[model samples]
Target: MYVVVLIVVVVVVVVVVVVVVVVVVVVVIVVHVVAAAVVVVVVVVVGVVVVVVVVVVVVVVVVVVVVVVVVVVLVVVVVVSAAAVVVLVVLVVVVVVVVVVVVVVVVLVVVVVVAAAAVSSPCDHASSSSSSSSSSSSSSSSSSFSSSSTSSSSFFLSFSFFFFFSSSLISPPFSSSSYQSVLIVVVVVVVVVVVVVVVVVVVVIVVVVVEVVVVVVVVVVAVVVLVVASVIVASVIVAAVVVVVVAVVVVVVVVVVVVVVVVVIVVLVVVVAVVVVVLVNFEAFNANYKIYALAF
Candidate 1:
């Protein structure tokens, strides 16, 4: 009687386990169906967001071009002229080339993507279906050949390369850890560049301000404004003469030196502009990196 009772208990436990498994499976299926609906909704929202982003980018490009016409022309002309004359020719300053390449590459990306979506993809889909089917079937067979001699063609080709390609369109963007690393590095670089540019600009401004202050004091000595100005002006000029001009011929050199200050200021502005450009554009970082690498 005990043996019979134990067998009955075992059977009851098996039935309970089977019912629980069936209930769990049903719950899992329901959960998955809900998850699939949520995923579809998310994908639709993402598609709309992408379209909005593209529209915004197009508008921004148009507006920026229209607004920055003169400043763009000035910077382009001055930078181009400076870039054209290679200092020592040993310095292969390819700033123009780099700018051109950046612009061209961005334009090409826009063009190629537009052409691929508008013209080529539909044609490619029709022409390459058979090759795709054959490849998929072979791959499926290799992975699951041992399981069944009789499997449906649909079962073998459960995957579509079209959808595979569609997923790949943004899969790297959506699910890649590398993307975050690259973005973080780029942001860090940009921040560092901006900080460096601000510092350089501040330094240049301070230097220029100091020079202007000195020039103001120098001008005070040579003024004829109401005689009080004249006295101060005379004293400063006399001081200048004592320090810089000992002989009559020294006057010519001093005049030449004064004449050259205008050119020196222009050169200074150019240097400041260049420092601003290099720091802001991340080019100086690359040069420094290369130098450090060579040193090692």
Candidate 2:
């Protein structure tokens, strides 16, 4: 009966676990679908924003173009109205006179600019022949030359309000109508020349610095090689000197040993000769005494 009850409890637990897993799987699928929907909504909203921005830019550009066209048309209409009124009242519109005067002035300045630019090329530092030409022009600026410079100066003086009164020493109004433009050109040329000179100087300095560095590197390498060579030569000379010193010491030691051996042999020979002489003298005395006794 106990084994039967255990089997029934295990079956019930297994069924509960399977039902919980199925519910969890269904919930996960629903969450995934909802997340996908939210992503699609966000993408649609971004596309709508981009389209709205494009529409606003187009509308603004059209409005600005329309405003500009309206302003231009209004100006034309007002100018035409003023000119018509003037023509009816005065028989000749003052606007036409002003336009003619401006056209004439512009044509004159254009002609002068062309003539001056063509005829007056700057002091040709490039040519060796220009100096003589410049000198002749200066010399001919004498008391009575009806040169263009003086005539143009007089003409400008009468037209302008200031040159008519100022003395030459005080100040002269520029004679050429293009005097301001000429001054600007001269200033620009001078600036360019100065810049060129400065750049050349900097380049020369950089080249010199590089050359100095190269020379220093070469000298350092030479010094290191010489030092190494000197070290090798000194070691060879020292080894030779040590070898010679050792040989001389060995020769001196051998000569001293031979002299000690000779001194020892001479001392031994002297001792043996003294001992033999004493023995011979003693034997002769004994024999003489014996013969004397027999004769008596």
Give RMSD to native, each candidate.
36.5, 60.8
Q: Model 1: residues >4 Å from true position, as ranges?
A: 1-175, 222-237, 241-296
Estimate TM-scores for all models. 0.25, 0.22
Per-model C-alpha lDDT, please?
0.36, 0.36
Q: What lDDT tens digits, residue by residue, belong to model 1 across residues 1-296?
A: 22123223323332333233233323332332333233233333333343456575754453344234423433443343233222212112232233244335434543443443433344455435644555566666765652342243334333344433443352221213333433343344333333333343333333333333333332233222212321333434444442332222234323433343334334434544543453344444445645776699
Superposition error at 233 for model 2 (Å)? 14
Candidate 2 lDDT at 11 equals: 27
- Report the C-alpha lDDT of model 2 over 33-149, residue by residue, as the tens digit: 333233233333333343455575754454354345434433543454344333323322232343344335434543454444433332122122433444466576764543544
Report model 1's TM-score to 2 decimal places.
Answer: 0.25
Best by TM-score: 1
